[model samples]
Target: MHLDPRLSFLSGPSVMAQLMRDKDWSDSAVGPPQEWPQALRSVVNLLLGSAFPMFVAWGPQLAQLYNDAYLEIMGAKHPGGLGRPLLENWAEIRQDVGPLAEQAMQGHSRYLENLPLRMRRGRGEGEEDTWFTFSYSPVQDESGAVAGMFCACIETTRTVLAERDLRARSEWLQTLFDQAPGFAAVLRGPEHVFAQVNEAYRNLVGGRDLIGRSVADALPEVVNQGFVGWLDAVYRTGEPFIGRAVPAVISRSTGEPPYEAFIDFMYQPLRDAAGRVDGIFVQGHDVTEQHRSREALRQADRQKDEFLATLAHELRNPLAPIRSATYLLRSPAAPAEARNRATEILARQVDHMARLLDDLMDISRITQRRLVLKRERLTVAAAVESALEAGRPLLEAKRHRLQTNVVDPDACLDADPLRLTQVLSNLLNNASKYTDPGGRIAVDARQSGDSIVFTVSDTGIGLSESAIRTMFTMFAQEQTALERSEGGLGIGLALAKGLVELHGGRISASSEGPGLGSRFVVELPAAPAPVAATAASPAAASAAARPRTVLLADDNSDAAEALAELLRLEGHVVHTAAHGLQAAEMAVALRPDVIVLDIGMPGLNGYEVAQRIRAQAWGAKPLLVAATGWGQEGDRQKATAAGFDRHLTKPFDPQRLVDLVGES
Candidate 1:
């Protein structure tokens, strides 16, 4: 460690100073230190002794001279870079730093913050990106003329790279926030200024501008709806608020009417580092459809329960009378007159039960799209007469005065006669049931244009406004109707509506109000009278005394035997089969002239037995009859398809069966 006396001013324990002391500067542009001027030497002395990173470029070459602190900035270019020209050592950055150095040499000074440059600073040969904060000033010669440049610099590469990464992360987080499925937003401060909002949030508010606006100002509708108050509460209390199926009324566009919506949402309080509430985070889903569906399900469930109860009550009513009638018929001590009366009672009760079952089946068929109409061209008078017959008993029981007016008795309809009759009877029955004793009922059927209109009006306990709205819905009954014994199943009007619609017709009901009476109007398209249309004479009843061979099949042994006895009583030879298989065998063996089969019989159902029997030659001559509880028109068609000549529902009058057998 021998120090050179000529460069003794290169002081301190600084690494650069020691390296300068041993350097051969004779060939340098600035020349040897011994020949250097006092101004250049004095500046170099101060630069090498300073703690701050400083550099000196003296003479026309602008040869480099730097202190120990500047060595770290030089990286691998240090030691050998001590006396070289500034551009020569920092050649990678010449285009950027060279101009600053030249300006300093001309007696100008410049300061730069974070000057970016590409330089060879690492041990590797490849250039690296770098930044620095530095100031360049003039260094003068002994003659007071600027001869070189001086720089004070600090590397800022780390700080710049750190800031760049932070900005990229912020952008990524914002992207995630915007893409959320539910509406999301951030509100800042007690005033609840909207700081950020996602696409969904913007759409929820009808695409209105919202960022930077307070909730009260952006959505004024929400202020009165208590939403703004909820937000304020969340912010003030620093507690989260979660609401489910909460209703809100919002106008989707400016000047549009407001609409209601149910939403599931949460407002979560945001806190600063000190734990003081600073904002709120909002997230939610629009659940209006879900809310409506849930409410509808609840209502349907309630209606189903009520319907089951009413159905049980209605079924029991007929069963009680039928059971009493059966007991009376079984008693040997009963008088012949009493037994005859009991038989009539049994017929009436059975008919009532059959009607109830028919209504239930019709509804099921309508819902399933399986109801088949037996459409026919008939005079309007005929349908009206049949309907009047069906409803007469109820009208008489209630002591209601009935009046009928068919303006055009010849008005024709291409409709299902039975279904049309059913519809009219239902309206008449409903009218009679709801009317007070001795009330007035009227029926008016007329042809206005190409359509026939039938109106049935009643002076009764009429419908209320609310009742009218739900009158045609399944199982819907007015409170007044429910309180009365004649409420029925609440499906009479519904069934009528279905039947009317099936015939390409519409039915409507209107009322002045409760106790003010009601009117029902059914309009159907009129048809031109058929060319072959003729009034048919009613057939007189014939005594069931013609003898014939008959086979009766039923899974219920009692039913089969009872029907067989009834046929035998009509002076016909009758045999019984307890099941379908036996009936098929018996028909082939005996070749009976008539066969009555219960459709629901097991061991080969009635349909299969008929199909089997018809496959044989002798079976063609026998009349096949279907006797079962399946009374839908579809069932009738099915029985016919199975080769049955006639289809009759079970519990049909014994006399009808006897006549069917005797005729065969």
Candidate 2:
């Protein structure tokens, strides 16, 4: 039968309703809505005319009918979507939503919020999840029997997904802020209430309750320090404040006074949606220890400068007398008394300078751990007597009376005898200088338990407690000087201490007070109980008296000339060259018994020349001696590797060079 014209399919407002009207529906399981029973037709019209996304699954097959809004949700599946089975068109979502439709067909009405359904919509072939809050209700027939399901759904995919993303991002940001190494905090609103705080921020503030409180109220201790004002200004003016090494008094304890801390910090303005400043973002780090370390380095640099200046003054003092004495000796008509006095004075000054240089070299060698000691068993009396001989000149010059007493002359020490003698000499000279004219100085040694105890007591300018404590420290005498006229590098006593320690001994000083005299004592471990074994003493070999050809290569003319003269005096044939190339050339021509190479020479340095020489046929024929001022251990190792027989420092004892070349 034909339907009434006014009640036909054309009575709908949506584009889908109109499309459904024009399309053929004969092949569909439910046929067409106009031919369906009144229940299905009523529901289909309601679904089609609705502004919201609505659909009707009519008949047992649950054939789909929906409006334009629902068609929009279907995307490109629209035209073919109508009159088809709901299960067929949206098969991916059938498992999740099909049960709801079946419940409606069973006469039950149900509601679902955010029902997640995996579906492929439009012409897109891939299935993705979409969410919706929807209701499914049974559509009743004229007799009250359920025939289909009427569905009203709202796609909440964009809204739900956006909300989930926002929550996750918020959690991630919270984790970062809490775990940041430096301090961090966030405040909200005009009152600067702490909206968020991290662990580092809490530690910075001494673990106080900071969240939900204003800056002034939460950190009252820092308000007077101007930090709170900085925060307020940032919030009010919408600008940032940065500070470096800012001093803050933080009370880590309940009752104790606050301690100071240095902090580097920044306060940035937080703005609202209206572009009005609301609160602040605070970040900072502690830098107190770094500041103190820099200050200490600056102090050490200043002390080093003072030491160098003092060293220059001490070295120049003795040169003035030596220069005057040299001028006197050079005069052709000098009288006998004047000539002898000048000669004596020149010799004394030279000896003094040599001692200074020797002390410096010894200290340097000790510091580098390159002091090769010739250790042997010797009597304490012999060592002390040798030291007294060395110090006799200074004792006479100062007019200091000397006395000696040995309780056991046989007291023995296992030590480097030369180093031991030098140590005692240093102590004796120190005592003589500090003592007034006609004052008494005594040297004594004895056997005490398993150690030998040697004491040098002097009636001199004594030491205070603090002076005694620092007497052996390098460069420790700036304030402890006896007089500016009596000058010396303060390293003598420090050198003595180092040498004594190396010999398994201890040296100490005791003094009542200034001008009350002082006593220095040395204790050394005695030689172990003697064994029955004995070895023959080797006789010293005399230096080579016969002349041998020697080549000296040095950039310094005066040094080369002086060395050549000293070697010639020993009756050796000598050839000299001022540069490395000239020396290498002379070596091949002369074929000398020895080649003395200076490390730092112009053009082909000592190392390069040595390499070239070693490559030659006559290279290893000559004894190679690296006589240089480069006294460092690495320099010596390099010389040895470059095939040098021996390495000696510059300004070496003339006799040592003679003995070395003599052996060659």
**lDDT tens readout by residue for model 2, 478-592:** 3545363266677888899989888888999999998899999999898853334565334324334557899999999888998899999888999999999998889888989
Off by over 4 Å in 1: 1-74, 77-165, 188-193, 202-241, 248-260, 324-344, 373-415, 420-472, 492-548, 561-573, 599-608, 630-664
lDDT of each prediction vs. the true structure?
0.87, 0.83
Instruction: Report the lDDT tens digits of candidate 1 across residue range 349-381.
Output: 778777887788889899787888888888889
Compared with the true structure, model 2 gives a TM-score of 0.60
Candidate 2: pairs in clash: 76-122
Candidate 1: pairs in clash: none
Alpha carbon lDDT of residue 485, candidate 2? Answer: 25
Q: What's the true lDDT of residue 301 in model 2?
A: 71
| Residue 551 lDDT in candidate 2 | 95
